[model samples]
Target: MSEFLTWLFATLFVLVVIAWYLTYTAARLDRLHVRLSGTLAALDARLVRRAEAALELANSGLLDGATALILAGAASESLESPAEHGEARETAETELSEALELALTEPVVTHVRDSGPLGQEQLAKLASACTRVQLARRFHNDAVTDVRRVRRKWTIRVFRLAGHTPMPHTIEFDDQMPATLGV
Candidate 1:
């Protein structure tokens, strides 16, 4: 009878430990999801800000006609693209980054520098916005990676700890800024 009681107690203890572990994992996964969501929102805001800055620069009449047209078109496309989720939005953002790089050539940088305070300020804002986008993207991707790693664990799979949560994916795009932007 004592042996049976010991065995029963051990089994109960093991069950409790497993339950605790699963609960902890589930809570951690929830926190990671929240972090990913917040980071994505921040990344989107930075992208929008960068697009807005590019549009402003294009409309300022400080740049050449061709450069201004290119910048405006790219900025408009990025702004018009659906903010939800997909490769289309990522492509649009990459195009905008490319446009910014092409439009902000050395000669244009020199022109902006020579144009005085307002032009310099606009350039600075654009540079800052681009840098923010880069950082935000990195942070978001890191969060995605962490969540993915944790979700892939055997324990999580065996216990179905993640529930029905859809797998998260990393956001990838060319966020590199123009050399002339000094970012």
Candidate 2:
């Protein structure tokens, strides 16, 4: 009878340990999901800002307005949600490609025709702004990729069994670069 009691307690202890481990795993998954969510939000926001900057430049006649508007709209729409798969993400990628092509194409080259060249300082500033926008876009895309990759993991499925859905990371942009670099 004593042995039976010992075994019963052991069984209960084992069950409790299993429950605790599962709970811990679930919590960890939740934390990752949260991080992914925050990163995605930051990424989206940056993309929007970059797109806006491009649009502003284009509107000011430094770039083409049609291309800028298309790019802005594409970037804005891409933030609706994080793409679940390569195929899904490709759609936004294609739109971005189109905008980039338009922005860099013959129309801009032909429209901006003038005998006088831009001053060195003005050209440098424009180049710097363009580079910054490109970097921001890349940073945002990388964050989105990281989040999506985590969501696709098998462990995330286990977490789902415990009633956690991998939250899609949606990024938000900054109006201007804060002292800090993240979002």
Candidate 3:
């Protein structure tokens, strides 16, 4: 009787411990997903702000007509891109980056800076927006990496601890600052 009781208690203890561990893991995973969602939202907001800044610069009477037209088109496309951080979004943002690179030659930037207070302010806003986008992307990607790492654990997969949470992917876009801005 004593031996049987000992075996029963031991089994119950092991089961309880397993249950606790699984619960902890699920809770941790849930927190990670929430963090990821927040980071993604932040990235989206930064992208929009960057696009708006570029659009404002394009229409600021700083650049030439053709340059402004090209920049405006790219910024509009970025602003209107689908909310998903998918390939289309990436392409639109990359196009905007390219357009910005072409439009903001060092001499042109210097010309804008010398134009007036508003020109300097517009360039500063654009520069700040661009920098924020880069930072937001990095922070978002780091969160994604954390979630992916946790999701890939053998226990998480085998036990389905993540439940129905969809996997998160890193947002990759051409967020590099223009050379003129970097300096």
lDDT per residue, candidate 2, 1-183, as tens digits? 999999999999999997897677667656665665655555445444444544444455454456657755665554443544244554654454355455545445444433134422222333444456456555655665665665566765655633645444433332232111121
Enumerate clash totals for all models, in the order shown: 0, 12, 0
Off by over 4 Å in 1: none
Candidate 1 residue lDDT tens string, 33-136: 99999999999999999999999999988999999999999999999999975899999999999999899999898898789988998899999999999999
TM-score of each: 0.96, 0.53, 0.97
Q: Which stretches of candidate 2 lie over 4 Å from their true place?
A: 64-93, 105-183
Clashing pairs in 1: none
How many clashing pairs in candidate 1? 0
Candidate 1, residue 39: the lDDT equals 97
Native-vs-model 2 lDDT?
Answer: 0.51
What tens-digit string does per-residue lDDT give for candidate 3 at 1-183?
A: 999999999999999999999999999999999999999999999999999999999999889999899999999999999999899999999999888899899988998999999989999999999999999999999999999999999999999988887899988878887899755
lDDT of 2 at 21: 72
lDDT, each prediction: 0.94, 0.51, 0.93
lDDT of 1: 0.94
